[model samples]
Target chain A: MSFDITAVVNIMGLAAVAVFAISGALDAARQKMDILGFMLIGTATGIGGGTLRDVLLGNVPVFWIREPVWILICLVASAVTYFIAPKLASRSRTLIWMDAVGLALFAVVGTEIALEFGTSSLIAICMGVMTATFGGIARDVLCGSNLTLMNEELYITTALAGSVVYLLLNSFNLPNSYDLIGGFLVAFILRALAIQFHLKLPNPHRKD
Target chain B: MSFDITAVVNIMGLAAVAVFAISGALDAARQKMDILGFMLIGTATGIGGGTLRDVLLGNVPVFWIREPVWILICLVASAVTYFIAPKLASRSRTLIWMDAVGLALFAVVGTEIALEFGTSSLIAICMGVMTATFGGIARDVLCGSNLTLMNEELYITTALAGSVVYLLLNSFNLPNSYDLIGGFLVAFILRALAIQFHLKLPNPHRKD
Candidate 1:
């Protein structure tokens, strides 16, 4: 039975966009932002990473501007979150898990795109990390919430590990499906463990 | 004597890139970030807005990626700022003025690019404002500093007004030089006045 890995990847990409938008909306609700603010942040968080990646890789018009379905997904997700967030007992928890899923998906997808664009593995890995993390970073910055980059959590590291694993699988001539699934699992599992156990990277030591 | 308007725009763009990089470095100095952090923030501040504009307008490879001189300029400017920022009597004041210059130049340049790309006047103006403001916003967010969007300052308004002025001048069929110079002056003067007088936009009133 031959399955279409491309279709699976596209669906996961949409899922990532939706979850990220939901996380952004939940954040906006917590920040007491207005409806427009919720939609703006949600859309930004959904597309910021991919937009950056596409720009850097010379992919014109960006994915969202060309398809716009991604934007509609974000808007709908944000509106839903805005209405449902108040009833949720653990909005923060939900946001984090949603972010984890988005991170995993973006890392793999971004790496794949970069590799296809003929970038070196290092640049591809970096692009993956950027794609995974930049949207959340933009969301936090826009909302004046806690910055993921400022935190000691294994956030970026998870994306980096996932991208590296994906590249390694590709090097082994694995099926595209195996590469995508392996990459996503590595990133998601690492992020989940980090959240569950409060695992963190070593903090920098600075002397004034 | 007639001048090369395109050359003038290019030169001004480079100047804006340098000033923004310096501002980013100053911000990093205040935050006590390391050298790499300074470079990262500086490069982002230098190119973030134009990158966003290019991506949205479907200008692939981005300006900086095409020329790379912009990145070189940012690195040099940031390094210089790192060495000299501490000796400055007032870093914040310097940062604001530098940002104002960048804002003015970028506002005009971005609008011109969008118009050339055949965008509507409204969309072009929005692109102008975004190109002028996004770099500084990225710098602020990365530094965990104050957000321009959250603040009541007339920052975005200055860009908007400048872009409108540019579009109006274009409609009059004036020389491109006049439009560019006129746009820059309006943005700079308005921002300068806002800074000098602490002018702000009306705050939104929200009731829980």
Candidate 2:
């Protein structure tokens, strides 16, 4: 946990939260929500997964509540997005790609954090997937999406794949840098490819 | 707490979870979601509030995860509803009233639990309102309701009022049974009256 290493991780984490918050804000705008709703969903999407992880692990007061800066960042980012979403619609696809980067970063970092908390690797992997996907899930749910019926994306799949890859790397006692890069690439690329090719998992509700 | 009292509380808690599960399943049926969706939302709504409560309080592993029977009950109740939802439509109003009962019970119990956990009175009260409303919120969100725009009746208002009353009684060093009964009556009566009269809070977003 050298200062420089921690600094890099922290910066990446902030970026992930910011992008997620912006996306959440965009979602709120699409739903024609009030400003308060925008900020609420933004904050929820940014910190929700980690919050759930910490809570399940008995780490109370929650990270955002304890450290006000994260909350501030999420709210600020969301407000900014609310103002910019209309102008960004045509370019929204670019934003989703950035979200993929955040998704990948969060999946690996979330798992590592859980593992550091002394949870079993299995739980850590679950944490990774949840941390990566739960924020969007919460946002979608709040936006009134019949989530089960709309379950046609590779969203969770990308997260699980990255988490498994990260864990596999860790099993060999590889350098932290290696696992970090390898896992991020796997997740980011997988998600990016999915989005670009309009990849979708089969929806059980849909008749073939 | 005495064993007999604890037993009473546990039974009440189980009933609350069961009714919430049934309501959640019914919501899924309304949306035509698959059986998997029904169980997912059912379990989520049933335990969501307690999970959120424990996380904020730093109590980990969550109540349902620790005592899995709660999850079992929620899933089983939901499964039953999946088969009976169509027939239950005419009787569904009765079920909503049952849900009101659960809401009242959870509001007081949630407050008491938070107080037992040594949270500040204000935080405990917030927990009570959340524990009562969040389950329904999750279900509505999963069922694709525009919640804020649909804010009506005495839903959260009753929970907040009852939690305040319960906490006030506790401040006087009243017996737990008395607080429980008083709070439940206050919440249930307020909610039932609202439903019977078709009362609604002003919809701020409504256009003239």
Candidate 3:
């Protein structure tokens, strides 16, 4: 079955934006932050990765500036999450899966954008990894957790795999639909497996 | 007294590196992070701004890569701060002042580097401001503080003033000594005054 690559990307981008925004809001709520703090984290988590991606690619006006819809989406998402957090707290596991999905989608889309901008495959993969992780990094910082760089989770590894798959598919001149589907499936499945199995990279100096 | 701009800049650059590295180490200790985290934050805070400036100017290898001394300085500073953090924490005010001095020094050094790289005057000022504040942004993120973008302190403003002074002096064909001393003094004094006077820009969007 044929898939619409552009449609898939656009939907994925929007979904990723919403999931990250919600995650940011959840963090702010947990921290007992004010409304402004909630809004800031939400907007940052929603757009930080894309903004960094655009800046590094020398894309003028940035993504959110070109389309105000991104900010509006974040604002709405933050507000909804802020108000409904009590009920949503029970579904933390669901949000974690959604976040994994968003991470996979963003990894593929970010790599594609970098490739379109004529970056080398290696640089494209780095950009994809940055795009998938930067928002969470920003969120963790705002939340006062040094875990952004210290967390031994398999988060960035998933992004690396997805980006590598995209590059390999493009190298063989594979159909764009197949590349997107395969890349997304690989990242999502890998991330889910990692979480379900409590997979983590070993810290060389981890103290018992 | 005639100032030697080159000598002054070199001195300030070293001081900036030391203070930034120290602050980074202190932050790592505050978070109870491991030694690697201390080193990462120290190196990042020491070179984050300048590295970004070089990248924006299309300069290869970056400044720190070109001069290994800066890396050594950062490493030593981090190690020293890590060992002395307990005593230093008792004197937080002094550390804050030292950090302010580093901020001023970095602003001037960054401005000069931008000019040397042939960037436009405006871009030079932007780069200088970035040099002064980007380290703090990186530090704040690593320390898990949301204050990076929201802090209304006179941080960037001080850098801007220093850069403008440097550019104006250079445009007047003043000796390099005059440019360096005048620029550094202006930024340093202004920042000190701002802190002493509790000066801040008026928030335009005060809640009614």
Worst 10 residues of 2 chain A by lDDT: A144-153
**lDDT tens per residue, model 2, A43-78:** 898988888777776766778888888889999998
DockQ of each: 0.16, 0.23, 0.13
List interface RMSDs for the candidates, in order. Answer: 4.2, 4.1, 6.1
- Which run of 10 residues does model 1 chain A get worst, by summed lDDT? A199-208
* TM-score values for chain B across all models: 0.90, 0.91, 0.91
lDDT of 2 by residue, B1-208 (tens): 4446667768988988999998888777766665655676787789888878877776677776466677778978887887777777789788888888888989999999899999999999999998988887877776776663146577888898889989988888886787887888899999999989977777668763
Query: In model 2, which regions exceed 4 Å deviation?
Result: A1-98, A118-130, A137-152, A157-208, B1-3, B25-44, B51-94, B117-127, B138-208
lDDT of 1 at B31: 66
How many angstroms is the interface RMSD of candidate 2? 4.1
Q: What is the DockQ of candidate 3?
A: 0.13
Provide the lDDT at B46 for model 3.
84
lDDT of 3 at A32: 90
Preferred candidate (DockQ higher): 1 or 2: 2
TM-scores for every predicted model: 0.60, 0.61, 0.63
Best candidate according to DockQ: 2
Task: For candidate 3, write residues B5-79 as lDDT tens digits.
Answer: 567567767877888888787887767655545665786688778777766776644555455577668877886
Query: In candidate 1, which residue ranges exceed 4 Å CA deviation?
Result: A56-58, A89-91, A120-122, A205-208, B1-42, B46-59, B63-137, B144-208
User: Cα deviation in Å at residue B121, candidate 1?
Assistant: 19
